[model samples]
Target: MIAVVQRVNSSWVEVDGKIVGKIGKGINILLGVVKGDTEEDIEKLLKKVPFLRIFEDDKGKMNLSLIDIKGEALVISQFTLAGNVKKGRRPSFDDAEEPERARELYEKFVKKLSEYVPVQTGIFAAHMKVFIENDGPVTFIINSKEL
Candidate 1:
């Protein structure tokens, strides 16, 4: 499992011109599930994401966490994050998990993350237009294997 986590002033996801999920003053997560990802991968992210001290505090230092700031989360399933471009000009998604399994893990991650903060999600497997108003443009790439 891999996540591109961005601190955002606001973010939303639109599918076919209809907004499906939105959030305010929080993190926008683009999540990818690879072939070998399991519940344990979700566990690793759960332990890091909510507690990540990427948000700034009154002192202007990056000291507050999502939980500390009482922020929301917009989780989006982004299978293309698994794309590999190391070999040729074309990107390969051979590492992406099957759709069904990816959806399962994606939902599980959303449900678990919601325990720490309010959470919204984009429709799994849908073509989405994600609009992100990044806060300070702070972003992090989290890999479950690395954690």
Candidate 2:
């Protein structure tokens, strides 16, 4: 499992012109589930994401966490994040998990996250237009295997 976490002042996802998920002053997570991902991978991310001290403290140092600031999260499924682009011009998605299994893990991830803070999500397997106002332009790439 891999997550591209971005600090955002606000963000929303729209599908077919209808807004599906939205959040303010939080992190936007674009999650990808690879072929070998499991519940353990989900658990790893759950332990790290909320407590990440990427937000700023009163002294302008990056010391505050999402939980400390009581922020929300907008989680979106992004199978393309698993694409392997090292070979040719085209990206290969052979590492991405099957749709059904991916959906299950995605939902599980969201449910677990919601327990700690407000959480919203985009439709699974849908074409979405994401609008994000990045805060501090702070972003991080998290991989369960690395954690």
Candidate 3:
């Protein structure tokens, strides 16, 4: 599992012109499930994301966490994050998990993360237009295997 975590002033996901999920003053997560990913991967992420000290403190240092600031989360399924472009010009999604299993893991991640911070989610497997007002343009790429 991989997550592209961006701190955002606000974010929202729209599908077919209808907004499905939205959040404010929090993190926007684009989550991907790849081949061989499992619940243990979710466990790794759960132990990291909410406690990440990417937010700033009153002293202007990056000392606060999402949980410390009582922030929300916008989680979105993003299979294309598994795309490999090392060989051909066309990206290959051969590393991505199957849709059904991917969705299951995605939901589990969202549900677990929500327990730590308020969470909203884009519809799984839908074509989505994501609007992100990135806070300080702060972002991080987290992989379960790397942690």
Candidate 4:
């Protein structure tokens, strides 16, 4: 599992012109589930994301966390994060988990995140247009394999 988390002023996901999920003053998480990912991966992320100090503190230092600010989270399934472009021009997704398993894990991830803060999600396996207003342009990439 991998997560590309971005601090955002606001974010939204639209599918077929219908808005499915939206949030304000939160983090926009583009998450990916690769082959071999499991519950432990999801569990760890829930604890990590909310506690990550990406927001600013009173002194303008990056010390505040999402939980500290009571912000929301917008998570989107993004298998492409695991795409390998080292070989051919066309990226290979062989490292990505199967769609069914990815969907299940993604939903579990969202459930776990919801425990810490208000969580929103994009439609699974659907074509979504995501609008993200990045805050401080703060972004972090995390991989479950690291742990």
Model 2 lDDT tens row, 1-147: 999999999999999999999999999999999998999999999999999999999999989999999999999999999999999999999999999999999999999999999999999999999999999899999999999
- How would you encode candidate 3's per-residue C-alpha lDDT over 1-147 as one tens digit per residue? 999999999999999999999999999999999999999999999999999999999998999999999999999999999999999799999999999999999999999998999999999999999999999999999999998
Off by over 4 Å in 4: none
Question: Can you give the lDDT of residue 46 in candidate 3?
Answer: 98
lDDT of each: 0.97, 0.98, 0.96, 0.93
Model 4, total clashes:
0
Lowest-lDDT window of 10 residues in candidate 3?
106-115
All candidates in order of lDDT, best leading: 2, 1, 3, 4
TM-score per model over all chains: 0.99, 0.99, 0.99, 0.98
Lowest lDDT 10-mer window, candidate 1?
120-129
| Steric clashes per prediction | 0, 0, 0, 0
Query: Candidate 1: TM-score?
Result: 0.99
Query: What is residue 91's positional error in candidate 3, in angstroms?
Result: 0.4
Off by over 4 Å in 1: none
How many Å off is the CA of 79 in candidate 2? Answer: 0.2
